[model samples]
Target: MEPTPRPLSPHLGIYRWQVQMVTSILHRLTGIALVFGSLMVLAGLFALAMGETSYTAFQHFSASPLGLILLVGWTWSLVFHACNGLRHLLQAAGVGFATVVFIRNSWLVIFVSLVLTILIWAWVIFGGAL
Candidate 1:
């Protein structure tokens, strides 16, 4: 006789998107991005210590389009990770436990992170004191 099939577990395609879920996922991703960004930082510092040629190469790459894109992504990742980390700390302190508050704070984390990233880049590009 043929065996009966078992039910499949729920997956991403089965569930609706929620802010908390997104925040959690982004927190993890930003953590990974921060690691890579840190490596890039170390590489820059090493280049600076090596000599003028190495430092110039590093600077040229950093000013390139692709490098600028990665820099922006890293910046956003840093800001998002910091904001979400603070939110997590608050949750651990027994705050924002209510559903509405949790959801609202999740959105707030996203909003604040984006605003910070924009503000930082604006300062860098425009040379205005923030």
Candidate 2:
């Protein structure tokens, strides 16, 4: 008879959260969000092609307060994913993976993501883009 397999070791729930972990989790989450967001975009395009009334209705819903909040959240999610993606790309390319480099780059990703989100929204609000 074959011996029984051993149990798996501790995973995500067993450890305190860190920047690297946050980036890892959010990467997957943002990917899923992006898929749904793309579907929304396709739906809007279809609606636009249907008629002026459909397009106007889509626009009105998109301009609602809740819609605006979701837009901001999706924007930030995209920014976060993009920032961490660059970090991962650097590691994959044989750059910036030393202990100190990893630590510094992790913080850099977090900082730059925040800055990009703020700057984008600032432009939307004050630059007459919104």
Candidate 3:
């Protein structure tokens, strides 16, 4: 006797996307990006310790377009991870449990993170005095 075919289990396509879900995924992704960013930071420090020549090379790379793009992405990742981490801490304390509140806070985290990233870049570009 032949076996009958079974219906596939629910997957990504089966569910409507939600803010909380997106935030959770982004939190994990940003955590990973931060790890790579930290490695880059370590490399820069190591170059500095080596001497002026090595440090200058690191600085040159950091000033390149690709380096600037990575820096921007790292900045956003840091901001998003920090905001979402605070949200997680609040949830752990039993705050924002209501569905509406949770969704609202998720969007709040995203908005605040973007605003912070933009503000930082603006300051770097336009603010003259340190």
Evaluate all candidate structures by whole-model CA lDDT and list the values in order.
0.94, 0.84, 0.95
* Residue pairs that clash (backbone atoms under 3 angstroms), model 2: none
The digit string of per-residue lDDT tens for model 2 on 2-81 reads 97898986797898877677777878898788777787789799989999999998888878998788778788888988
TM-score of 1: 0.86
Point out where model 3 deviates above 4 Å: 1-10
What does candidate 3's lDDT look like per residue over 1-130, in tens digits?
8777988768867779999989998999999999999999999999999999999999999889999999999999999999999999999999998999999999999999999999999998989777
Arrange candidates by lDDT, descending.
3, 1, 2
Candidate No. with top TM-score: 3
Q: What is the C-alpha RMSD of each candidate to the true structure, in Å?
A: 4.2, 3.0, 4.2
Residue 68 displacement in candidate 3 (angstroms)? 0.4
User: What lDDT is reached at residue 11 by model 1?
Assistant: 83
TM-score for all models, in order of appearance: 0.86, 0.83, 0.87
TM-score of 2: 0.83
Q: Runs in model 2 with CA error above 4 Å?
A: 1-9
| Residue pairs of candidate 3 with colliding backbone atoms | none
Of the two candidates 1 and 2, the one with more favorable TM-score, higher being better, is: 1
The lDDT, on a scale of 0 to 1, for candidate 2 is 0.84
